[model samples]
Target: MPDLPILLIVVVGIALVFDFTNGAHDSANAIATIVSTKVLSPLTAVLMAGALNLLGAFLGESVAHTIGSGIVQPEMVAGSQGLVLAALLGAIFWNLLTWYLGIPSSSSHALIGGLIGAAVAYGGWDAPLYGSIGAKVIVPLLLSPLAGFLSGYLLMVLLSWLVVRSTPGRVNFLFKKLQIVSSAFMATSHGLNDAQKTMGIITLALFTFHEIPEMAVPFWVKLACALAMGLGTASGGWKIVKTMGHKIFKLEPIHGFAAETAAAAVICTASAMGAPISTTHTISTTVIGVGASKRLSAVRWGVAGRLVVAWVLTIPAAALVSALCYWFLAVTGLAV
Candidate 1:
């Protein structure tokens, strides 16, 4: 091991803070339906989401690896702690802002966008991994929600058709129990996809500091990020929960189960593919699909439009903030 600088330690701490915020903001993705449908109390749902998220964190490193080298080169950015800090600030601020406004935004994109801005600030036109960002982050951000929506819609249609002969009361009773399991699945997938991002950022820092010659994420990094996110999830965010559970669609137990299952499958697949797709996007689209399956009118187009606006703006907004922050650092002669 090398001598760790105070800056490195501080960076680690800040990364954990971002991880915590990601978990808290995204907890709504996992528990919204289960809580909304009366399948689980809020406390019970959050506790389960938190625990499962932690457990899920142990399952994959692909997303971490994607983020580590996918956005900006750690080696290039490592010497400039100010730049890194600026990027983190951009992401953290965005997460808090969206959470406060009860809008579900992508924590994944915020970090990536911040990194893009910081890299552009530090490297000008020579920013590392620019191509990778378009291929990995932007492409996935656009497509995953479409996938989620389609899958959720198709699943809901199939399930609805299968159970069409069942009484409404009976279907509701069955799906209520099913929602508990679906929530757990979604929470676990959420951890697998989201926590890995912090792990990547931390590992990227380690590489930049030359503590590690490569961008390999260590076990401690993974565990720390995982735990941070889980605790955040346990803390929960009910405001966003309302937005996800009720505003996107009027979820009954049946809709909740379908939406969760559809979203979980999409997220887990993306995790396996090393794509850092947004749980917020996936779940929101899945819910929208489930909403449409009942009737187009069941989905709140106005609220959905607002969320789409937030999604469209997240990357650019975080990037602009990060770019400005890095500019401040540069102009002040504090970049390194």
Candidate 2:
């Protein structure tokens, strides 16, 4: 047998690469509101957001456990290290593809889809825990955006009603100040959930290698994923920032504040629930909800529809890519 540690190392490296791509692709989720509201310059916003994301990564492991052991049984794959690598390759490629096209796709879904695809490829038809996947991932993925939209719409309506007598300038000035706080909360919530995905995958790899008898995320894996995600956030991605900060809806300070707050609440709640959700999906729909609260036509539904199509396609598309990747690895005898 090959030296498993060497393969594990390579897989861990690839996991970090996936985490980096995730941070860059999803950084807009961390900073979009503050940037759009002009409450902070893009640079300042990302830096602040990145720092908070790093801090938040140290929060809990419910999400990590969900991804690490809930998605697929790690021991079933042939050369499990190779499976992770193939899966990361598929997910990373999808993330880069979507980023280049300025689509706010879900990295969480991509990784989950890749895991399922690679598992099925390696273990034939009986590898995945379908019920766990549906409960832990699919349901959360479907509901988070809807929660964001509903919360944002209601929150905006309430805020508008409460501040009805306030001058427009006063409200804008106040929300501009508050937006800094809301944006940071969103970024922290993002790190709480998204960064845990890689930490979970790496831990699952450890279990596959028998480095640990049980599936548990080590502190070192947590630190590495957190730092990688933070660095990627610092580097930033302008493409999706444009899509998120503008295309979904034009935001004034109050709109930005409302969307950020609502999305942050939904994500944090999901994180505590051990469910992995797309920060992008939540934030985009929150913006749409906030816009619609002002006027139904205020949201760019065409763009929103296109985004929804991409969201719906993310799982199947990434799965197909990872399936091909697994096939290539198997045919080459690389995973044997």
Candidate 3:
């Protein structure tokens, strides 16, 4: 068995690794519309997103606190490095698998699912605080994407009707310039919401092991977690970018601006309420809304259906992986 100190370090390292994966996996949410619309090149788009993500990290810490406390009981989590390790591995593996498949699923759901799965595997179904999780996670997840779709659909319809008399070139030219603002909004919302998840996990680990006080995620903890996520976003997740930017919708500047703006609005509102929503789901649904606004034929329902399947499977897939890892750790008596 590894020494307790070394085991703690390893667990924390795994947590950060999971955080990095979260950033790379979700970076597409921030830049997909901009890239698809040619508002920014791949490299410039990622760089812009990375910078805004870093700036947005300081916006709020409520979501972090929620994740740290809302899912599992603090007592169940404490002194269990193996459990935390299992959770991180589960989330990381699911993220990589989805990215490889070019699926835009929820990294947030993956993380929570991992933790709940491992916790249930070890402690049974009642191990998780299902009430808190239901109120905070499950409900919001269901509503957010639907909200994004409706909002994006309405925005596009309004924009189109308002500019119907304008030439296509004039509308495209105007919206191309406006896409910059929407892109910034998306990036900022992505950072504020997604990075806090990593912060939540890290703080949960620290609190569990008595490295930090209960109920408070330290300032330094927030800064370091935010920085790690920002760096990961800066590196970009190129594979999934193509999937989000081109596969779901062939967007023009107008579609991009409307979809991104709608997604940003939903995400930022959720962030203020400390809900950790899936930015991927929000943005993808928005794009679908935008595409459908032109006509139902303009949207590719077949491809969109596949993505929804991936989202449905993400949580359970991550949980299964985490549960297996936990079983391995328990059998070997490793310090993970």
**Which candidate tops TM-score?**
2
Q: If both were scored by lDDT, which would come out higher, candidate 1 or candidate 3?
A: 1
User: For every model shown, what is its TM-score relative to the native structure?
Assistant: 0.97, 0.98, 0.97
lDDT of 3 by residue, 1-336 (tens): 777668778877887777777788888998888887888898998888888988888789989987888888877767776777788899999998888877888999999998888887677787799998988898988999899999999999999999999999999999999999999999999989988887888788787677876868788777877787788888888878888788888899999999999999999999999888899999999999988899999888998999899888988899899999988888889733
Report the error of model 3 at residue 105, Å: 1.2
Clashes counted in candidate 1 amount to: 0
lDDT against the true structure, per candidate, is: 0.90, 0.88, 0.86
Candidate 3: the clashing residue pairs are none
Q: What's every prediction's RMSD, in angstroms?
A: 2.0, 1.2, 1.3
Off by over 4 Å in 2: none
Residue 99 displacement (Å), model 1: 0.6
User: Can you tell me which runs of candidate 3 are displaced by over 4 Å?
Assistant: none
Give the Å error, residue 217, model 1.
0.6
Cα lDDT tens digits for candidate 2, 214-300: 888889999999999998898898999988889888899999999999999999999999998899899999999999999998888
